[model samples]
Target: MKLTPIGPAALVLALSAATLSACGGGGGGGGAGGTDAPADYVDGATFTLGLSSDPGNLDPLMGAGSALFAVTQFAYDPLVSVDGKTGEIGSQLATDWTVDDTTVSLTLADDITCADGADLTATDVADSLNFVADPENQSPFLGTFLPVGAKAKGDDATGTVTLTLASPSPFVLNGLGSLPIVCPSGMDDRSSLAKATSGTGPYELTEAAPGDHYTYTLREGYTWGPGGAGTDQKGLPAQVVVKVVENETTAANLLLSGGLNAAQIAGPDGDRLEKSGLSAAETTGLVGEQWYNHADGRVTSDPDVRMALTQALDLSELADVVTSGRGGPATTLAVNEPVACPGDSVSGALPAHDPDAAASLLDAAGWQEGGDGVRTKDGQRLEVTFLYQNNLGSSGDAAAELAVQQWKAIGVDATAKSQNETTLTGTIFGAGDWDVAWVSLNVGSPDQLVPFLSGPAAPDGTNFSAIDDDDYQAGVDQAMGMTGTDSCDTWLDAEALLVQKADIVPFANNTVRTFAKDAEFETPGQLVPLSIRMVAK
Candidate 1:
């Protein structure tokens, strides 16, 4: 597939780190279910959802983050949508579509119109795709969702938009389903998109209060939702308020007091929320994954050092600590449900905990242990600056502390640093000042991860860790040739190459829970715009 070559200047602020704590959740309950709303649909009700952090730069194309992705769904619509339960491709803005090796042609619905009452043309849709496809635009979704080097053409008379890809992508339709298309107004004046909505979704942004909250008013006569779902249904909220609540506990308290309609509680607060009899929607996501910087000059660049560090800690204990005993061992890099390849690639692929073995590896690498129990090679101490997201709450902090103690016992000087989502993204993808990171990048398709794993290193590309495993790349090359599930076996084997060599250590998978009091909704990754329903208490 074609790849967007992002320069150093753009890399610093382009890629936003995915929040592990707020990975996936919606206003409904018990797995992905929340579509079954009560018979009474409370009209004129305001649905309040809590976010752990502010979704900076509201422009959908330029910004990326779980918060921003979640918020964008309220005011923007994708070309298509995949059913969270059946995995079936459904219509959103595009009424129908035909996909093949190098081309995808989508037929737009005639009735679709922008929030401003302007008719949405096929040209608008094509323009949105082409904007992201251009490298100069620096859209983070380029390689992840929209194929790089892709081009689009539109015929307004026939209401059809055609896209030609540079290479054959097995999961092209699924990726397109996640990309939000901007209306002509937003595309014309990109600056207005920073704090406004100009899409053809079921709602329009009425107010944006950066760090406080974002309010969206429901748009009447919205009938072109996923699978022809309409906003005229009973119980649909008249307004949506996304309140910024950084603390999980505070969010839970709000949910209990009925002050908020929904909030995702990943920490200890989740237990109480489950018993409170509120509706919920749960999505399994990677909660604890470790990555070593393979860039030159970093101590973790050495293969021996990476393997030694992997064997230094009891991953099971770390997993429990990180997830607060609620999660289990990770099975695959793609942890979310409706996973294209449903199989384990992590078990028996990593080294078991053995401090003695770890120390031996260090000795073999010519690192001598000093009087202070720190290893030094060529007059340089083996010091590591580890980073983890602070949104993982107290459990994440505890897990980092435990990992540090374990590394110290092996004569490695490791320090744990906690950063919020925005700072952490910049540190890993921009500053490149970290040795190891406990962060997660969630995606449904294995192809979506290739850009972040194998391509050019940061400052030049999205491969933040600078991973350069030839065997993994070979496997991916082979897998890319096949189509759909036919390539799953090869994809799983490719993930194994990374694990067997200790390039990445994925340890925990948590059932991310989002609780709702007076509302019900579903989230494939973010809340489905059409699945939301307001209820009277």
Candidate 2:
């Protein structure tokens, strides 16, 4: 399952610093916007960002159903923010917080003034929570986000909102972080959160002129923020106009041609970026991997066979064909993220390379090489059909083709097929018609991984592996029900358990980047730069 967002989980916990040097694409020109003097803003500096896909809908509360959720961050504020770079809790609408096992008390900042100049309060936070939790919203990601029993309570004066959880969940804060607070004054009707709407962030969303462009004007005299970004960007870019360039090639060409400042580039757009003097930024995320359906009662259910399959493929070689030392192999979903057990962190959870062990594991599983160079057991061919979407960009295609060859070399009968975006989603992700599929799934939280990885969900669910191992499910259950851990032991243990299952093979995590042609702006400091507040050039 290929997913997106939150560039490197570390930005929230660490610093965006020089992370841009890792992805090798996109660069910005430097200049002053409003910092010098809000009134004497640069005559020609306008921060124009680009989105490769159309933001389907502008409602953040609508969940991840459309690409628009990412853009909605431009005009919305979540109760909390999970620092992508740091993996720690950071304030957004909430100023401070206190968390026990199942309850979280948030002290909402009183100084917040929305675009409408209405004083933000705890009551506004409650209203936002209720909006997402409303069953009528029909958001596919609602269950994983709002859940069933979570509640918000508090008053507007003190600006305190208390979140009560039904269980100890590692994702309670993250879930809140994902929830965007709407204006309570007119929030009773969701239509108030319109495209050309108002928000309280550093920049006020003045226009979302469908596809062609969107604009944001500085919220004059605005000073309230939750820290990190909220405090750092004192002066805003005079105006930020985001342009929609759906083609990566055109977007990259414009960035290189000095037309636009920065554009997110994937696929062939990255081919010449390394030598283009551009920075490559990235962080660990929902890595694209090879998923084998074990619960479907295929040969993949055999533990040794799974191990052998792992041994047969050479990830190092695969990386070679991937991005010239840019791709890092993944063994599990959260292998790249920092996780603690109870009191401390450990490195034992990292994925390791073991070519010999992989070959041996498969051999022991009785998948011997047949006369035709294909592995077989009792006349059954060791074959699995893998599905991949062609539009994901060059990296996805190159990665899929490499996977096919690697698996075939090990006597595994593997074939790669390309499908369009909608058809692929309907057939493989939705219909579960695939045996083994290579996909990328990136999100803000690792706990929400359940709805996509395991657990019972509507319409076939995201258990792409079709694996129903009790042991594996137990680890997932424990990971999902955690609040805070002082160490990474249990987290690593669960990660190892999931990796050993071999139902999902995490190969590499890519970067989400932005570039600018003018100096009046600074890096957006977000995986999807527009999601978090943007600092002016």
Candidate 3:
């Protein structure tokens, strides 16, 4: 598949880190009449999902969670959309889009209407995007895409709308496809999203009680749907209900007991689930991670020491604990999943890990093995501290901790610091103060990784390891300038360079899989879920 240079965020940010503590406390009461068949025309049956955390927000812009996106498949509509099955661009709200030598114009669907019953148009799209892009709003994700004041004016000639870009941004299609249209009603640049539910997608949000459950029903008489509704043997669920049940073990148990339709089981449990009368489907998980923070200064800056450090840890052990051997070992930030950096697969001059070679390099760099067998240079001990967060959710801490064991076996003094949410988020990530911290970032797509690992991204600029390389930066910039197949090749080359330099360590390409019993819209393995593929059973 041809990947876009500018991809979606790594999917990890959308992961469920907290549970529905309050819940308005809905009873996991069995559905009335317990019929296997749903009582709706589209969805065969209303399915109940056990999510790892509560819905972060109903606001589309601030919302996080793979399940939230699953529900939003109904509420909002983007100008361009991808095919869930093939990652191909299919029409939804936009009937067609045209690109000039520099400018791009999008044609909106005539059938477009919001849940508030407002007719969606180009004006709404422009207004909503501007709201998120405004400096005052301070949207966390705004920096990932077009910069502030990026989306310029749009003109409506008769019935069609044309949009102009600030510059020749090749990622325009990527930006437009993900930016959704919002209603102008009760909206301002600094308005609070108390009950902001105005979108033009498959389903309308009936109700959402934060820290509780979310209920969404199909939009009646909806004509604009993605792909065919369903196959002869398959049907879309009439309704999609998501409730937060944080315990991974509980998620697995409920799935086995048949009380829950499908649940995302992590690590060892996933293995048990696959073997226990359950089917498996995975998306390329967005969680990109690495060990970093030499700024605190314990000599992680030494190239040979850093290389040796990376070589010491065994990924197979990490994978065994984190994914239960379900996914492959991650070697670079951008794995070969949809939305991966086009540069991730590019050709490079980096060498793969060789323990013997690592030891040789360390020795050559003056790391003389001491009495304790620990390499020491200038009387400094070869050691580092690793930090991570995911107290409530799966952070693969077990794997990271076991990696501590592996490094120790390799004669390296490494300690794993599994932190509490406040400490991890506040001290490590928030303060940028640490020795070597381990963290995972899931951007719905690999393109999302460009900003996280790429240097000097707008606003917050997260190139956490502070790996500032001119050649590597140029490669990423070149990829950003590309739109089609060449973009992929450029990104692949950049990825190779990153691997060679050991800028970031890859652990595993998240399979993006979640277990579901109902199979409402049983899509093949994918990273981002397109609103178009959702069917009404």
Q: How far out, in Å, is residue 395 in model 2?
A: 3.7
lDDT of each: 0.78, 0.54, 0.52
* Model 2 Cα shift for residue 76 (angstroms): 1.1
Cα lDDT tens digits, model 2, 370-418, are 8988888887998877776443456666767777776777788877787
Error of 1 at 41 (Å): 2.2
Q: Give the C-alpha lDDT of model 1.
A: 0.78
- Candidate 2 is scored at a TM of 0.73
lDDT tens per residue, model 3, 1-537: 111001112122344211111000121222211224333323245656665545344566643223444444456666776543345666667677777746666666665667667777677777777766665664434534443345544444433555555545545565455555666663543243434366666566677776557776666545544432211222344555676775667777887776666565555666677776565445554243454553435567676777776676665555555655556555445442334343344123334546777788788988878788676889888777776544223536667677677666556777667653223433443434455655555432344455455554223334445566677778766866667555766766776677666666655555544665534233322222221122232
lDDT of 1 by residue, 343-389 (tens): 88898697788989999999999999999999999999999999877
Q: 1 or 3: which has the higher TM-score?
A: 1
Alpha-carbon TM-score of each model against the true structure: 0.92, 0.73, 0.75
lDDT of 2: 0.54
Worst 10 residues of 1 by lDDT: 1-10
